[model samples]
Target: MLQAREGTCNWKANAASGMAVHDDCKLRFLELKAKRTHRFIVFKIEEKQKQVVVEKVGEPTQNYDDFTASLPVDECRYAVYDFDFVTAENCQKSRIFFIAWSPDTSRVRSKMIYASSKDRFKRELDGIQVELQATDPTEMGLDVIKSRAN
Candidate 1:
C-alpha cells in the first residue's frame, strides 16, 4: 500500500486508501470513512445562458442552497474533473469546489472542476458559491477546494 504524506490526508482515517496505474498516469484514491460527514454539490455549464448553475445533490439546507453565476464562457477553455467522492445513499456532507475556467480562450473546454483534498473532507458549498461569484474566470485557474466532514 502507498503511504499518504502527512497533512495531505484530511480524514480521520489513514490517507493512502488505494492506488491505480492508468497508462502513464498514477492515480490515488482517498478513502472517506462512514459518518455522513461530507456534502456533495454539482455544477454544470449552461451553454445557452453563458453561465454555470450550482445545486446541491440532496436535501436543501441553509448551507446547501442552489445558486447561479455568470462566467467568461467565451474565455473559458475547459471543465476539468479533478476528483469525486463515492458515498453511500449519496449523502455527501462536504463541498467539492472544483469549478474553474482558463483564461486561454483557445483551450475551449468550456468548464472545469479541480477538487484537491483527502479523507474526512467537509468543505461547505454555500461558501464556494460566494467565492465563485467573486472569481474572475479569466484570471483564475486550477483552484483547489475541499470537501468537509459534517
Candidate 2:
C-alpha cells in the first residue's frame, strides 16, 4: 500500500493563478485555493498505483464520471483532473482546477492548473500532443481533463 502524505507547506500562487503548496516534494494532498470562490480545490495521488483520486471538496459530485470518461484515452498510466464549477446552489463564478500528474512520481513533473479564461485546453502525452476547445465551460474543462487522462 502507498503511504498517503499530506503537505503542509505555505501556499503560493501557481502559473494558473491559484494557491498551491510551496514545495513540490509532497504527494498526498494538493490544495488549489480558488481565487474567485473561497472554496478549495483539492485531490490526492497514489504513488504506488500512479492513480489520482479526486475528492469533491467544494465541487459537484454528480459529474465526476463524465469528467473521467471524457479523458483522451480509455486508459492512462498517470494523469489527474479535478475542478470546481458553477452549480445550482453555488451561483458564484468558479475557476477550473486541473492536475497533470507525471507518470514517474519519484521526479517532479506534475502540474497544478487553474484556468477560466480560454476555450481551448492543450496537453501532451507519450510524445503525442492534443488540443481541445469548446464554447461551453464544462465541456472545455472536460476536454482538458480528458486530454490529461490520455
Highest TM-score against the true fold, candidate: 1
Give stretches of model 1 more than 4 Å off.
Answer: 1-38, 59-107, 111-150
lDDT of 2 by residue, 31-131 (tens): 32312221322333333434334433343343555554444331221222334445557564333344332222223333222121111121211111332
**Among these predicted structures, which one has the highest lDDT?**
2
lDDT of 1 by residue, 17-132 (tens): 22111211111111111222233333333445433344223222213222122333444312212223345678544433434443444233332321111111113221332133
**Each model's lDDT:** 0.29, 0.32
What TM-score quantifies how close candidate 2 is to the native fold? 0.20
lDDT of 1 at 30: 19
Candidate 1 has a TM-score of 0.22
Q: RMSD to the native, candidate 2? A: 16.5
Any runs in candidate 2 off by more than 4 Å, and if so which? 1-75, 92-150
User: What's the lDDT of the predicted structure labeled candidate 1?
Assistant: 0.29
